[model samples]
Target: MEGRLVLALILGVCTAIPCHAYYSPSKPYVPPTEKVTQLHFFLHDTVSGKDPTAVLVARPNFTTAFNNTPIPFGSVFATDDPLTVGPNLTSGVIGNAQGLWASTGQDVLNLVVYWDFGFTQGKFNGSSFSMFSRNTITQTEREAAVVGGRGEFRMAKGFAKLKTYFADFSTADAIMECNVTLIHY
Candidate 1:
């Protein structure tokens, strides 16, 4: 009778401990590994005149930046007014962006970037990736934004480090180079 009681007590303690879940008897546990990718691209920004037809009077407004076309106030898409609306923009060819006025109490420029990597070769041949980032850009280098991408970059998250290549203030045009690194499953 004493041996039976002892055996029952031992079994109860073992079940309560959950030792097998932590240290499996069959195979050793291994930590998860992360896969990462890095890329570099150039962003050319051109600030055009405000849209006169736009109904909103907000301090910050939306604008478009064309890929490989660095003209100020010009877009890749067709539009009636090039001076105010720039050009009409298409998917994978434009960055529908907005910049808040410094007087509006925001230090950085909010940008929604749609990068067209379609012309390139290799793994990302025809994928269009987008990122929403804040730019506190200066004359020197800085980490301007945290970027999460779509399409080929699905489920991938990363940061963007950028430095100004050149800036032409008179024309409201600038060239910035960005290095992006992402980690995913």
Candidate 2:
């Protein structure tokens, strides 16, 4: 009888003890904050002439190309617009855009755009944000792209939608609208 009792007590104690050495209390789930930013600007065809690779600019001033400097000028991106210019961007620009041709058959343009919010006037004054766009320029509208942010947008994940305002095939000039939605802590 005593042996059986002892075994029962040991079993009870063992079960009472936690299986894991470290026990973390359950935390209440907290959702991340959602942020959305919309930018409407002209994507100027800054290339001098017709070429396969084109460097496009979007800034308050038409002269400034995309650069790393924190300024209010604009962002620069490259695309295969059939219009060409120098591969390098002009000095003293704010943001950059890089485009990689995915496939010749599909004519897919993979765009990675970096926008510097450091020199802005209000709300987003010192943030570095980047977005990836798989744009099939042949199509009028493209799917929402993924965006990962830095600086003030730490731990941010989002979707970005682009709408073409205008596309001039001859001059390779275009205007675009971007709407972005992000969820971050």
74-184 in candidate 2: lDDT tens per residue?
334445322112222331223333343221121233333443222232344465455555555446766555566666676666765666756664444454544556665
Give the distance in Å from residue 147's predicted Cα in candidate 2 to where it truly belongs. Answer: 3.2
Model 1, residue 24: C-alpha shift (Å): 30
Best by TM-score: 2
**Clash counts for all predictions:** 4, 3
Off by over 4 Å in 2: 1-45, 48-119
List lDDT for all candidates, in order: 0.44, 0.46
State which candidate has the highest lDDT: 2
Model 2 TM-score relative to the real fold: 0.46
- List the candidate 1 regions with Cα displacement exceeding 4 Å: 1-33, 48-122
Per-residue error at 148 for model 2, in Å? 1.1
